[model samples]
Target: MSTTLANQQRSKIISLLSPAYLWLTVAIFLPLSAMLYFSFLSDVPFGQTEWHLTTENYQAFFQTTTYAKLLWKSIKLGLIVTGFAVLVGFPCAYVLAKVIQGRAREALFLLVILPFWSNSLVRIFSWAIVLRGNGVLEIGLNAILPFEVDVNLMFSTPAIVIGLVHSYLPYVILTSYLALQAIDDNLIDAARSMGAGKHTILWRIILPLSLPGLLAGAVLIFVPVVGSFMEPRILGGRVGTYFGTVIEDQFVAVFNWPLGAALSFILLAVVLVILALSSPILRRAQT
Candidate 1:
């Protein structure tokens, strides 16, 4: 009877998890597997297209320095955006989670997440309108200042960074807010009672305790930013060519699916290696 109950509980657990497992296999694993296979082929195995297994796609990456430089550029862009998001978001999160009271907190929290309410394309274009030469930002600034200053940031790296930071800043805020909220107030009070300074409390207590969430937010921002093409293409214009844009061109413009797949896999490998290397540090921070 005991054995039968254990078996029934195990079956129930499996049943509950089966749908999630199925979805992962169908939505994630299947596509990844297909892409991996495609990466090894000389051409896509569609219609009358002749194709065979080849390593040239992967070889092309190592053969050319252009892809490496673009990948590094994308990585740099990801780091810059993540850094700005953390620097800006953490303070806003701290104010919201620790300082604010009553309805003010709720209002500010709503504002923090306001970016999510609008379409990303709309937001990019809106920034473009403000940042373009002689546009809203330039006009407004020139009006305020004694001298005229050129303030065109559109179609530049700065524009890409600004747009990306605006888009992903909320992730850091939301995650850090949750982490900060979880810390007991008594712990902070106790530190104060022990004669800890404000900077000391923040550095030793609040920051350390909330680091996992910060790291989580950083990873969330970094990963998608690295692979992003649309924002760069629209915001950076002629200067927007990154690893992601290159891969996109291969697939969309050049119609080279196999090469695109190879580039995609290389990017995936790099991201995974980075995560694996940093995960130990993140885990250590939690302790």
Candidate 2:
């Protein structure tokens, strides 16, 4: 009777989760599978999709130097933005986790997350307003420094990076704070008692312990930054096209669904490869 009851409980738990599993399989996996299948086929003339299996789409993607360059640029930009987010976010999170207390900490945490409540498009548009010709930022800069020349900030690579960093910085701060909070207080006290200074303790104890969160935040920033179309579309202007724009053009403007699907799968494959490469680093941090 005891064995039967245990088995029955297990079955009940599985039954409860079965609906969620089914939904994910249908909603997520099915579309991904369809994309994968379509990516293997060729595009017909006038934007028709043919089901015949061919590697031409993949070949075309690689053969084009511009596409390859854009992909590399996207990866580089994502990495740089992720690095900046971590650098800025780590100290802020450390302060929140270690220094603040009670209501004040709660208030600060709210402030950190409050920006996320607004629509991302609204925020990007605000940046556009500030950075455009003779806009708020330029006017303010000129007012402050009489000799300063008005700098064009909109439709530039730097503007896109700034926008991406703003969009994702909150995630880095939240993750780093969680990681820092998990560190034992005694470890820091032990280091201090051993005559270590604040800098030494931070470097030796806190930073190492907080690395997993840092890595998690980096991954979070990287994944989105690489695939981001909106920020680059609005801010990138004519400086250069990223892979996201290329994929978007194929799908929306050109109406080449098969080619677009192939490009998307290729992008997905690149992301998976990055994640796979980073798995060892993540595992090491955890251990």
How well is each residue in 19-118 modelled by candidate 2, as lDDT tens digits? 9999999999999898777778766434453357788888888787987888889899899999999999999999999998999999999988876998
Cα lDDT computed for each candidate against the true fold = 0.95, 0.88
**Candidate 1 residue lDDT tens string, 2-21:** 99999999999999999999
Badly placed stretches (over 4 Å) of model 1 are: none
Q: Highest lDDT, which number?
A: 1
Where does the lowest 10-residue lDDT sum fall in candidate 1? 278-287
| Candidate 2 regions with alpha-carbon error over 4 angstroms | 44-51, 144-149
Candidate 2 displacement at residue 99 in angstroms? 0.8
Best by TM-score: 1
- What would you estimate as the lDDT of candidate 1? 0.95
